[model samples]
Target: MNQTDQLVDLKNLSPDALVDFLEGMGKEKFRADQILRWIYLRGVTDFSEMTDLAKSFREEISQRAIISFFTPETIEISSDGTRKFLFRLCDKRSVETVLIPMEGGRNTLCISTQVGCAMQCSFCLTGTFGLERNLTASEIVNQVCAVRKDYSVDNIVLMGMGEPLHNLENVVSALKILYASKGFDYGPRRVTLSTSGLVPEMLELGQRIKVNLAISLNATTDEVRDELMPVNRRYPLSELMQACRQFPLAPSQRITFEYILIRGVNDSQADAKRLVKLLHGIKAKVNLIPFNEHAGSAFQTPDENAIRAFQTYLLDRQIVAIRRAGKGLDISAACGQLKEKLENKLLGSGKESSLQGK
Candidate 1:
């Protein structure tokens, strides 16, 4: 057998899987815990650094197993202190992860589950790239671990580049690692999975994982939503809202409906009224994201007055809604601005080009 095949990546295994693998290797069950502690709790990558293990045992295990971690090809820091990391995968595919620092020392990390996206939301930058591939559980989990090396991330959002529900299995498997006490150890509430209203997967996610859910609900009616997010056409607003209603929620928890307000599209007093009516009986909070404009996006950011008026309309009706401030815009690290910079580098033209036509 190839030695590389014999070498298991401990980072890819869950605690139970690690136990089984170690047992099969004729090593003590406790070895699994020791190795995991060194990798996760201690943040040690090399076997030589795991001093608690006997030198001979470490050498033997080193030859039979390996710990894998993805290092970023480029780390870009925005003027606003946001950091975007472009990680080059083993297969040479690239993905971006971002770290956003907030008030009171709280920080949130945005992670990507897919290389590109299939949702094809008309206004999203990543949608323009189309679907490249879904990330593996290790690929997903490593994002959190890697960012933790720099900033003590207090929360995580699956809102980086792709529709997380589109890669449900791997996303959920990665969540298992993030929720594991012996792994990333992030509380379920602190991790939010944002989807473009994938009803079936949303229901499954609520059942399988206890993390918070955020829906990218850019429109109030099927006609408008179909234009903004194509996924809405398949799962329509009614069915998506029904899934939200059926989703089990812990006490004091409310689903976050993210509405990206675009000028001349889905940002008018009439639209806001329809949205209030549509969310009738759902336990929800609203995040009004004034569309993050990119070089080639047809959408324009709504004026502050228009955004505030829409927010005021929601607030008057007892809806908890807030206009989310755009971050990392200088470095193209905002919601819909993530793709162009990487795409420019990939093309090797060194000129800032939009993927809109491509």
Candidate 2:
């Protein structure tokens, strides 16, 4: 059977499933560990690179199954050393991933979980594109593996193109792969999954995985939240807050509330006070991401003084707040700026050709 026809995302399969598949193919069970190491640890795309395996075994594996790793079709490095990658998926759908180099020897890989987004958040460009498809578990894992091959990733942020909790199964599967000792082995503390408050999945994730949770709580009030993020309308602020309070957290672990600082929108002192009330009793940190303006986006970043005042209010009230510095804006690959430009090019061409013929 052609491996591609198997419909198994090798990255998604558990270690036992991988072993079973290899053994069923008449390959030694020990080869499973080696294959997993190559795919996850070494990030090898071609079977030929599995030098530990015998040539004949490699050839057989190559004939039967192939590893898939996305190569960056476009790479852009910001002046500050933040690198953005536009990766081409196997199905020709493109997604963006970013590597942000931080101080003290830390690097974070921002990974996407879907081709486009279904959340339709008013502030997010990816949501404007509409839902394309959920990336396979392997596809999600491959972003980390492929990017880490070039950069030493010390942390991961599921804050790219799509709403991760919306693609819960694949997200959890990828998280398991990352946590697996036989694979990447990244500790749960090193990974953060951000969601626009998908309540059911949030509860499920809290039970299944212990990774850090970042909620895109752009607004504190239900009326404002509904205006900013449509997902809020379905899962109201009260219910979402209840879910967060119920979400299991270690004594030291605190949920991260990501609030995009859109000028004149949710930046007021009143909003900050309301936010404090909303987050009452739950251990949480606020990430104040100043809006990174993208073309056609209706929002604008709040001024420095306003941001400082907002931070000061949170700090005075004992709410931990960190300002997320703007990065990768030059490449339009920063937070909330991942619309597939190639698709837009194709659409534009179609329109031009149609006009010419008419």
Candidate 3:
């Protein structure tokens, strides 16, 4: 086989899979652990830099296994320290990853699971592109690999361009690598997978892995939800709520229900009360996101008073509801706003003003 044909991307393998692959190469499983630390912890791509590995073994492994990373074609930095990275895939399709600075010194890396979305959530701009393709396990994991090159990612959210549960297999494998002690070493608390109410896959994901689960629950009733999220039609509020209740969450970990508050749509006192009623016994918190208006989307951001009133109503009922600020608002990287920008390329050195039509 040619050299390129023999090479396998080490980043794509889970800890167990990597060990098995190394064993196939006549190396001990412990070698996989050492290589994982070198790749993830040290961010060293060159096999020669793994000083502990014997020189001859390094040459053999380097010939058979490869570390693959694709740098972002463009990066847009926000004033609030949010960095949006646009990475062009090998197929020429691209997806965006956002690094959001949290209140503390840590940063949250928001990565995509699919090239586009099939959910067709009315408010989400990504769905406008339709489901181009599901990302590979390597593609999903490499998004983190690309970002960690410059920033320390304390938290990772599979809440970017597509519905994570749609690409269940690849997404699960990527999560396994993320939580591997020798890989990224992220615990359940540090990683979250947000789904657009895919009932079966949500439960399957809970069973397969222990990452935090967040549901993109926009409306309280099925009628309103059907108009906003098409997936609600398949798994209505009743089925979805039942699935959430059945979800395996740690005693300390609560499922996050992401409710995007849209003006004159599903942002009312009655809606808030119904939300409280819906989440009655379920261990969940409401992440209230005021709809981030983008081009082609008719929805408007709710008034601050309206947003606060919604939160206050939930708070009064003893539910934990927090309003999430649109961190990358200025750079079109906030919630439900990665629209036509997907077709355009931001030129120059990652400046917001450098936006040019593709």
What is the Cα-based lDDT of residue 156 in candidate 2? 94
Order the numbered candidates by lDDT, best leading.
3, 1, 2
Q: How would you encode candidate 1's per-residue C-alpha lDDT over 261-332 as one tens digit per residue?
A: 999899999999999998898889999988877778778999988999999999999999987777887887
Q: List the residue pairs that clash in candidate 2.
A: none
State residue 31's C-alpha deviation in candidate 2, in Å. 3.9
lDDT of 2: 0.83
Weakest ten-residue segment in model 1 by summed lDDT: 349-358
Clash pairs, candidate 3, are none
Error of 2 at 27 (Å): 6.2
Provide the global lDDT of candidate 3 against the true structure.
0.87
Summing lDDT over every window of 10 consecutive residues in candidate 2, give the lowest-scoring window. 349-358
Q: How many clashes in candidate 2?
A: 0
- Index of the highest-TM-score prediction: 3
RMSD of each: 2.8, 3.4, 3.1
* Candidate 3 regions with alpha-carbon error over 4 angstroms: 1-6, 335-339, 346-358
Clashes of 1: 0
Candidate order by decreasing TM-score: 3, 1, 2
Error of 1 at 259 (Å): 0.6
